[model samples]
Target chain A: MIIGALGPEGSYSEKAVQIWILRHRLDSVGIQYFADIEDAFLAVIQKKSDLSIVPIENSIEGSVGVTLDLLHENGVEIVGEIVVKIEHCLLSKGGPEKIKVILSHPQGLAQCRHFLKKYFPEAELRSTGSTSHAARLAGEFEEMAAIASPEAAECYRLKVLLPNIQDRKQNYTRFIALRAAGKNTAEQVFEQVLCDTEEKTNRPENSSHSAFKTSIIVYLEKDRPGALYEILGAFAKNKINLTRIESRPSKKELGDYHFYIDFEGHISDAIIKETLKDIKTKTDTLKILGSYPAFKA
Target chain B: MIIGALGPEGSYSEKAVQIWILRHRLDSVGIQYFADIEDAFLAVIQKKSDLSIVPIENSIEGSVGVTLDLLHENGVEIVGEIVVKIEHCLLSKGGPEKIKVILSHPQGLAQCRHFLKKYFPEAELRSTGSTSHAARLAGEFEEMAAIASPEAAECYRLKVLLPNIQDRKQNYTRFIALRAAGKNTAEQVFEQVLCDTEEKTNRPENSSHSAFKTSIIVYLEKDRPGALYEILGAFAKNKINLTRIESRPSKKELGDYHFYIDFEGHISDAIIKETLKDIKTKTDTLKILGSYPAFKA
Candidate 1:
């Protein structure tokens, strides 16, 4: 089995994959790393990997907009989720006091802003393509340090001069594992997928997977005074709870948008099916991304 | 009078200010440049500048999350708006064939992806803090080029090797001019504010000024099944058209969020006032960012 994720080997995406591996105890898995979220997602589409892991949202920064956009652009279905606590370590070849520059991914740098200002106010801050890329560069310069994953420090042979330097300790990132959408997808083979998950966790098969959530995208046929209200009413009338709702520009006009929404309930449920039926009547386009068990439990 | 914007003198924020200046015909205003959006906004809050202009949203990129978060962090009221079309120019000292690296702000590079893939498939793409910053560096290297505003090309003394290189011709950015919130702000002195916008556009003062839009951020007391539905009900029942609605993390937890909403009608309107009253009852927190005229003619 080959699993794809965003790379240079030390990304939090890789960490999420590791967490999944431990849960499933997969021994025959090979890891493939891609340059970006889209590329990682494409690995599944292109048949290079059986599954792809993607960082979906962050507790501090917000949704990874590009990841959301790519999910919409591709025909991938999310099958599983791994929520990882994000911990950035200030790494260096020498003492922290000797470091003249700090390199990291932009988000990493933003997460450590308070720490950086309080400690290395004069150090030059630079952004790299990935945190591990920064880690690799940090190893080459004695006066440089990096904010990255501990896995990256190990891979780059750099010491963790300081640990968990993020401004917020509770910061977490949600990564979803995706596979190509089609006949063998989650809905069609729900029982088999549960069996696979059951083998990993050593849990009972009949533990009530009632917290399944469905993802969908809706586009309005025309701009009206209460177009969105009419759509949301469908869910509200059925007592369906929405977990998330975000609007992205359709790129055709300023006011027009495509709404990405996640609501509680599996698509197989009668109420959810009815709600989607009503949504379809009011929307110009409706795409059911997938139904997956919520990570909350 | 002074206007603050993010700049090395040629950013899109700077261009947004120039558009506002032309529309208002402000001749005596000095332009102040800051390293980032926070600093530019801080200039107004710290009383170093009377007002600051910020890029609030882009047609292609969606809302500027940092700008939205900063507004919530500070006591700034959006007093006016300026919408400027974004046009990227491929700037370089040498021919396109000689360019080996393309540098730009991430958004700039994304906007010109089609152009880059077509013309410079092999050129390495790099991200910068700002497009103008990339242009400044591009000017120093003959083998490097940047995608920046035409104004940036002028400031950096680089040739516009290609014009209008943005993938979308309709790409535009909406900028809002902000001032300190208080009795002296637009709300307390609504008449004077309209007079100001009216004089700048050479229009009669009494078109009712009904085109005003108000921005607010709301946080639910707790995550409830119909919490957001109840909040949207306030605007829907009142027949207020929501121009934009986005959710950002409250930084407290994963599900908790700050919903930034923009809708038609100012706070001065009777229906909008009633809506806020009812909304406040249902929400744990409500912040009235400000009311401003919509950029629509």
Candidate 2:
């Protein structure tokens, strides 16, 4: 199976996918990467890749809308999830005073906006594709500095001007693993068994399949008032507690939106099946995007 | 007052602020423009400019976290909001077949991702500072296409490959006007008049002040379970009807978040004020970000 990630081979998506491969003991010879989240999603859509890892949200930056919208428009399903800590560092080719500009992804640039404001207030901040690319550019130009990862600074041969410069101390990203429209039963069962075995080694008191969560995206009929309420009524009736729900524009019809909902139970649960049936009865479209182990479970 | 906007003169934010200035009849000489959202925010924070305008959310792209977080950290109040339609065009310095790459601001790039996927599937997509910057780059280079505004295409003398290629039919941006901590009575009175005029223009039959919404950002003390519940309980008691709520990491402390909420009432209402008091009693901090006329109202 081919694996795709967002990268020049060192983005957070790359790291998340690599960690998933290592944990799953999957082969990586046919693995590839793209520079943008949409590219990674399209790779899955076109059957160029079996699975793609893209960031859906970050603790510091909130929602990554591009990923959210692509999942809304396409037939890809989010079969699993992974959380990676975001560690941002300030890198420069020379001392801080020598830097006239700072470069990083717009998200990275925003994550460190406080540090940038407090210190390099006069530097012209710029946006690039990824943190590693920013660090690479900083290494190539004496007047440039980068807000990136420490690993990226070393890889790009740039010195760390300031370490751990993210505005928040505990920033984490929630990335979803996208696969073609159906489930891989063998992979799913194998992952569950592995998780169970791993839990046996050092199980936390809260560890169980019950703790796992599932996310699904649905689109309602046009300008339907109480439409969300009707769809949500199913979950409420089934006692399937919803953890979160957010809306993204459908893009197919003006003002129509896809509702992304997260509930506390897996899709295999009987209650979930009943709830989805009820939702389909009330909504114009219902797409089961994925059933995944939610973050920190 | 010194006003800052995004520009080298003509761009979305520049046009947005200009519309605002014309609507309010403010002076052009008092206005200064920056190359990016952060720069505009900084202009206000550093007292280089007394106020600024930045795009905070788009119908297709959702939240512009850079602007949101910058203002959140810098302690600037969103004095007002303006919704501007986003019309994107594809410009080129080469023929369609010769164009090897497409460049744009990340948001603009994401907005047109569907177009790229369907048409120029093989083109390498790159992101730059702004749409106008991409147009300028296209003017200086060969074999490149830029996803930008028609104004940008005209300004840079680039060929328009396609016009209005955005995925959403009605792509609108919600731009927030910022000022320092305190309120100016004259500006407030003027804004009230403007707000009333806006309501009169857009008021549909069966519309009320409670028809569309109210937005607020709340922060709670750390290590409190059901803190959000208690705060939300106030609204539940009044049946105020919450439309949306989003949580972003509060840079002040690790593992803490500030919840931004949209409910359905003005702060001037008695129940809303009582709700605020109840929420204040239950939470560490509560900042009413703004209670302006909700978009599309």
Judged by DockQ, which candidate is best? 1
List candidate 1 segments past 4 Å from native: A94-101, A113-125, A184-210, B97-101, B113-126, B184-205, B208-210
How well does chain A score by TM in each candidate? Answer: 0.86, 0.84
Q: What is the interface RMSD of each candidate, in Å?
A: 2.0, 4.9
lDDT of 1 by residue, B52-164 (tens): 99877777767776787788888888888888888999999888778988888766776776687678766767656678888998999999999998989989999999999
| DockQ for all models | 0.52, 0.23
The top-ranked prediction according to TM-score is 1
Candidates' C-alpha lDDT: 0.79, 0.70
